[model samples]
Target: MSPSHLLALRPPPDIEAQVVAFREAHGVRDAAAVPHVTVKARSGLDDHLCWLALVPAVAAATPPVPVELIAPRVFPNGSALHLPARSPGAVQLHLDLLDALRPTRRFGYEGPHMTPHLTLALGRRDVNLDALLDAARLAFPQPLTFTATDLVWMRKPGPGGAYQPVEGWTLGSTPDP
Candidate 1:
């Protein structure tokens, strides 16, 4: 069967540590998964060959995008809390990757618009939403900025699997390695 995969930009070390700490404090699962801002998620492509084709295209067309984490925002349905990310270059990179992978038609979210975010917590009915929001605000008060220099290819072997890094391509640099 075809593997499930996603393209993402991983957070820098310090920010990643904070995300892990928050997850641990709140008893969330999948804490080992790298903290990232997803570009495209769970595509239809089945194998590395397609990824092999797509990664080079993405790297060739993308430059290093500057990413800035803005304040925390809740998903409209209150299912998750996230840190909104802003970067024109990152948006453009998303569009370009979408174009390259258009044939797979694997884009998960519905929209002409993509709201890039770094998820802080998954909402649960048992948890007090307001309290979680307050804590998230305090945990991530200041804006954090970084250069999104690489695209990571992540894969899950089967249903309900943890995503693991398969490969990576550096933006505006040598071809996929």
Candidate 2:
């Protein structure tokens, strides 16, 4: 199968470490995953020319986003835990990507449905969410803030494959007209 693709904003190393440590403490961490907020969800953009042509323009047009990762909470399903991020710029970028990459779009977590967040743990069974919430609060007692300066293009070769970054672009780096 052609690799599935997604765009994401990576948290800074320090913040990433904190999240990883919290996940490790609870034994729910996916070591292969990098801590990130999904700007665009999974899609079937298998053609390199498609993304290579699209991402540069969108990223250069978008400015760096300032993200504030607030309280950690589990989804209503109780299967995944995440740190919700507050960022208008990120949201706009997501909306822009949805329009630019409409052909390959497979996920609908965009526009009004979009919630920019960093997944802490996913697909765990029989875990106590309340305990996990408490632990997350302790680890991140306050909102973690950072400038999201780049967008990473991540790929997973097949179902159950690890998502590894394939390329990246610095936002708003285009010279002024």
Judging by TM-score against the true structure, name the best candidate: 2
Worst 10 residues of 1 by lDDT: 103-112
Q: Give every collision pair in model 2.
A: none
Alpha carbon deviation, residue 72, candidate 1 (Å): 1.2
lDDT (tens digit, per residue) of candidate 1 on 1-177: 546777778888988898889877876654235678877766544564555576676776688878998888888888777888897776777778777776446454622478777877666666565677788889889988988878888777775455777888888886735
At residue 60, what lDDT does model 2 achieve? 92
User: Against the true structure, candidate 2 has what lDDT?
Assistant: 0.79
TM-score of 1: 0.84
